[model samples]
Target chain A: MAGSLLIELDRVEKTYVQAGVDTRVLRGVSLAVGRGEFVALQGPSGSGKSTLLHILGLLERPTAGRYLLSGEDVSGFADDRLSELRNRHFGFVFQSFYLIPYASALENVLLPGLYGPESRRSLEHRAQELLARVGLADRASFKPSQLSGGQQQRVAIARALINQPAVIFADEPTGQLDSATSAEIMQLLADICTQGASIVMVTHDEETAAFAQRRIRILDGRILDNGGPGPAEG
Target chain B: MRRALRLLPRVAGFALDAVLAYRLRSAFVILAVALGIAALTVIVTSIDGANRKALEIVDMFGHDAVFLLGGDIESRAVGKRTLTLTWDDARTIRQSIPGAYLAVPMRAKSNITARFGSRNFDLPVVVGTTEGYAQVWNWPLSEGRDFTAEDVAHGAKVGLIGDTVAQELFGDRSPVGQIVFLGSLPVQIVGRLSYRGLSGGGGSVDDRIAIPLTTLAQRFNLDRKYFRAIRVKFHNPEFMDAHVENLRSLLRHLHRIAPDQPDDFTILTADQILQFLAMLRGGLVAFLGLTAGGAILVGGFVLANLFSISVAERTTEIGLRKALGAATWAITAQILAEAAMLTLAGALLGMALGMGLGQALSRLGILEIQFSMKVFAIAVASALAIAAIFGLRPARHAAGLDPVQALRRSEG
Candidate 1:
């Protein structure tokens, strides 16, 4: 374990037995994410990029091998304990934004704070600031239904940052956005990285990966290289 | 505890928002609960009122009052349904029965037609009674004087009218001194009887006309010696058991009945009526309780099914919350709280409706209604129990959702 590493995975393997057929999703993948570094994980569809991201985010546990978060062997932790760790140490942003359809933008942003340490008043203030940061201050009361795809993604990013976590796991943050909107979201992620937050993002786009400080490529449930220039062309 | 206290309002607010989101479903839930609560409220008030009415009957009739109802009139193949215990038995009971104050005998006929000038009416009851009839029956006059002993002694053609009959016969104008015909006989109205509403038999208590016993025998061509019933009042009610025995013995002796024979008449007192009413109330309460329980069960089933469907439908949202660090308990509490809020609102609505309906019925004298905190407590407790018993299964289903699987399913 290195002192600079925020997330370290060692020989992690995940297998599913669906309908009595073995489908190994992650094959002994090992990876390390440093503190204050944006690491883009790139692979084509069915390349297990999202599986690796989910394992890093503590959303799923590997069938075999160790997962360490900030130097703690948390692979065997209980669901409740893992949930706490996820809340205190990690955040997530999804491709579809995953904003609560019934909640306003402000409420969506303040959601993580509800499960974290922030008081309601502080959460409110923080939510307001984050909405402003995302340039959706005037639309804070708008619901996810009323927002465009780009705006919804921005709210998701604001929510991800609300808990002030060590790392964020983004599974295709701009997968549904136009190139211009994608560029804007990449710029926001770069800014967040500069402010001392680590990110492990899953994307197939080379340009989306270009925003990261380093790149990792996975194929056929195996990591090809931890520091790849980019995923192999094809 | 402190943390839960803080979370309470948030949980409630979130639940309220979710409920408002699915307005149509929530409305149906509320309606189901409202019906259950309404049934409970009405049942409680109705039973309470029945008990109160039994007490009121005791107060109205007084403990010392007793009525001698003719028995075996139809069973004996009697020609005219004539009284078996005649005027001789009435006299014997008055003379020999201890603590006897008044022994007023009466002859009453039902569905008699009466006319006053051009106005015609079919009166429900026509009572032939002596001078003390008003006092014996606890029917006091509202206006005008009572028929005196002189009127009865002379077999006077005077009628004491109930308020309902008076109103029908004379309108707003007082019926005192107005002459009305009972069949072919003309009788002058002397007194207006107070309105007593309905009897236990559901007949109009205030729709009868009373005339002197002698007048009824002479003018209506009725036998003077036989009366339909004898009503007696005692000096002290505590000795009612002894007087009742004495009266029965004296009546049997006067009728020349053997010791083993069943008396030809039945005795009714305020105490006996109270016992009968108490039994009636117990049966009524049991029936209402079963019915209310069934209603609540059905209502709870509706709620449970709706919430179960809701939980199954909102798996993605629940997963999102879990991903946001909401524990299983937190999700369950929120669901249960939503259910409680719904039932509470419906219970309050039902209480309001029940109170309004109960008050209206009471005011109309259709039924007496009573309320107490016990009723409210039962209603609320039932609603909460229904919510909890029914809400738990769905909440558990929600709590059992896996975030990753739930999110993926939603996405797919």
Candidate 2:
């Protein structure tokens, strides 16, 4: 797959107002992600890493500045249009897996496609293919509660790719997994990137950041470093 | 296109799946809705059926028929008035009003005992004119025949017994041409009347015996000018109002009453009875409507409580769905759909239970029960409306959740 620019953020800012006091989270942050790139965001707790990820994933609108996704300026897009763009062009994975507990693994994977106008049969087929790609083909009918944490995260990843989006935004995707499962999930994400799907992951762990082709560290809502010489000898 | 239509079932299945997730809670909510709807159904149907039955009784009396009863119109008075309507008045009304079809003079005596081979039963005795009597009342004869003009001219000692009277006096034996002693008069039973069943109030009209007016007057020594009441039937049913006004004028002239004085006689017609029933049905429907509305309000409260709790329980899920590209409207639609599904299911169950209860009650001789499509449609529509109205706030709350805060809260 050809690598190209997929997301561009220019002078983005997010402010939190509580009790008549405004606290700026992201201060004029600018960033860009190329297609099929494996990028990692590294930051400590309360460093606005998650907020930046949310803005990039189209889940939150910046208080100021422009966000362009796949050459379309989405700064003034309505909620519905933003959602449509997200569903069509991007996918999401979270640290907690966030699978709907009452739904089966297959159903959790099929959730993103449900809002679209796709037929049920086609949606199911796509969900099954993604689950099989995640190596959980036999566990499609099992509820999230019945699956292990690692397996649930894998289903979440499968859900993220069900729409065949151009980019995947993973917020601490392996934060809740064991080291062995974490490595396996990182390898799986890397494999997806190799298959032409870009990924932007947020993580605090240096070892998790090492799996990415590029790494950026954020501090106080500002980029402290970008494209560093890998994970500090760890 | 056909495939999309077929997918409706899939959507419905998902809705059902969501409802069944909390089995006990959903069941309780549905049960509450069902109970309210059922009560509403039975009450409305029974009252409507009773009103219809009352109208049928008025129709059985005759078309365009009016009753002249003695009463004080301005004040409520106790005991019967002594001012009687005479047989002469019946003749006068028949001759004076060209629109009059038949005028029959009637007198009634209650609780008269009849003896037949030591079997005795208390029955009502109705004495009326021999000519145009059956025509004016529209009474159908089940056996034998009705009294003719010859019976009145000769003052014959013959009588007709109703179904209930025949059953009591003769049981299975044929009552035609049999001698039944009516207060030691020993009147011969000439015919047996058909069963007209109950007249809305569940009182059988068949438990009465009819005798010729001339025979009754002669046997009891009652004067011709001192009869009980006069029943007038009009030539055309549509001219009942005009005929009633004409009667009022004629009575005012005959009784020598002043213009300011209220007439001593009251004119009663089937339309008046119909109007009374219409008022009664309207009152009943309104009462049922209020009750059903209150029940739906309670259901709405329950749904609001349920949705509020659901929003709290699924906060993280809402965040996750939003992150997965779910719009605010999509999230809201999901919650609202769940509520509507629950309410619709409850309404269907309630309608079934209500109709069943109504049928059982009717069989037990309680209120008369009926089923109406309009009522069922209203019940279901109200249920959906209640769900939507009450489910809005919680749905909006769920949709407006911040993905970052929701995720952080869930982890914490």
Candidate 3:
């Protein structure tokens, strides 16, 4: 992994309240990822690993604390501003592979560019290239329903790279795939890291975590070391 | 805004896909909208057609003409008893009024039978009138000539039959040289009145006969002194209301009636009939409009509720888009545009459906149905407005959704 810091979180916390009971999901968790790095967040069920990824990805705002992207504090950023950052600076892949079912794989891949700040006419070629890179170039016209789980995940990965986002937040990217397909997806992730994009992946499987150059472990909503994870190897 | 504009196609695409995906639900919403708009189109077109027909009547009846009848046509109160108004009154009004008016006295009896050779048909009506009858009614002759003043003065037994009467009496042959007997009196057909389908007053004007006034008076012994009605025409129509008031006063004075009592004779005019018809159609449209409006209200609410449910069902899809960088307004715009498209489709379909229904009603001789362009725009605009207006709250609800919460809900 390269050295310059790209994302830094200082004492981030998230609390969920339900029917008058407060459950703290992530408590005083600090983390950072350098440019062109591959890191995996490993945890058991309800260990707040996914929540941490969500906050890091700007899809969520921590209940308390500061977050910085490229060393600029963005923890209290407005929703629309955060959303723009999410589109330009980050990409996300969920376990369920939320590719719009009715849209063709190519159309889903073009989604990020379509909503970005400028014309996306050029993104069409970029989307096709990303699909080819993910090895689903021939299936571009196929809808999500027509594609297998592995194929759908690849499409999601292609979609994440459409805007050339700085960091990719993948939450259990291979959770629904069989072992063979899962291995293929991890190798794709490794290739993406080598392409100079940072990746912060959450996974409970140690084998999935092995694909990353570094690993951080969380339990019961708290970091086990450094009171957090950092850009350096944890 | 530029980014939102760029995503416009995708937003439209996604909405359309959702509509197609939930076919049954979308259809129900569309059905509600279609039914309401269909009703609106039919009623509006019918009223518009009816108003146009009334205008046609005004055209036929002549804008400058007024009818003074001895019978009660103004109100429901009536007795078919003979009137005291005579030919003398008609002569008086014609000579006394300085407005270049024409007063033609008319005497009529209905359901009289006429015989030509061995063939006989029941006449819808028989009118005993003077030489100016054709000119006063603006009725043109299709064949032969109208009865001259000499025929009226000499008590000539000459009849001017309408085209319909001519058809019944002489088949395809022209009836000009033929003799037809009205009861025991034989009369030669002097001319044929052109076909006029419907009259402004009421029934078909082409199904009756006109004869010399003196001939009818002397033969039927229908009091030579009296006239059943006087058809009045003015050279200038703009003075119509003033002329009506003047005639009322003149008639009242001639009859020696008190100021408080209702006039013994009733006057009818093309404009009055037009106004009455307009009022009748106005009430009908208002009632139908309110009913259709209620339907629109119910349909709009149903569509709104359905859209809200759709937003709920697609919460995950919405969250995904927001995560991909769609803003609040972008989401709202997508839903609003979808609603507009849905209602517009329904409106177009409903109009097509309404045309068929309106034509069916027209075939039944209810009212001549014609679609006016103005009404078409209004009907379509109204439906789209309802759907768009009611769709806003649901769109706002969807736009206000928290992305993380929505994502969680979908995943769960």
Error of 2 at B219 (Å): 7.5
- lDDT per residue as tens, model 1, A46-123: 988888888888888899988888788999998877777887778889887899888899988887777655589988
The residue-level lDDT of candidate 3 at B323 comes to 87
Candidate number achieving the greatest DockQ relative to the actual structure: 3
Q: Report the lDDT of model 2 for residue A119.
A: 72
TM for every model, in the order presented, reads 0.86, 0.90, 0.91
Model 3: residues >4 Å from true position, as ranges?
A1-3, A117-120, A226-234, B71-84, B112-123, B163-175, B180-187, B195-203, B213-225
Positional deviation of A91 in candidate 3, in angstroms? 1.6
Model 3 clash pairs?
Answer: none
- Could you tell me which residue pairs clash in candidate 2? none
Q: What is the C-alpha local distance difference test score of each model?
A: 0.84, 0.80, 0.84
Output the number of the TM-score-best candidate: 3
Q: Per-residue lDDT for B2-119 in model 2, tens only?
A: 5335434544555566777877657766877787778778777888787768767787866679877655444636665644566667778889986986787777665678778888
Candidate 1 local lDDT, B52-139, one digit each (tens): 7677677777888888877743245446344776777777777778789788889887777889888887887789888788888777
Give the least accurate 10-residue stretch of model 2 chain B, judged by summed lDDT: B1-10
Error of 1 at B98 (Å): 3.4
**lDDT digits (tens) for residues A1-234 of candidate 3:** 124789888888899999999999998887778898898988888999989988888888899988888988987778888888988988888899998887899989998777785566688999989999999989999999999999999999999999999999999999999999999999999999999999999999988989998888898888764323463222
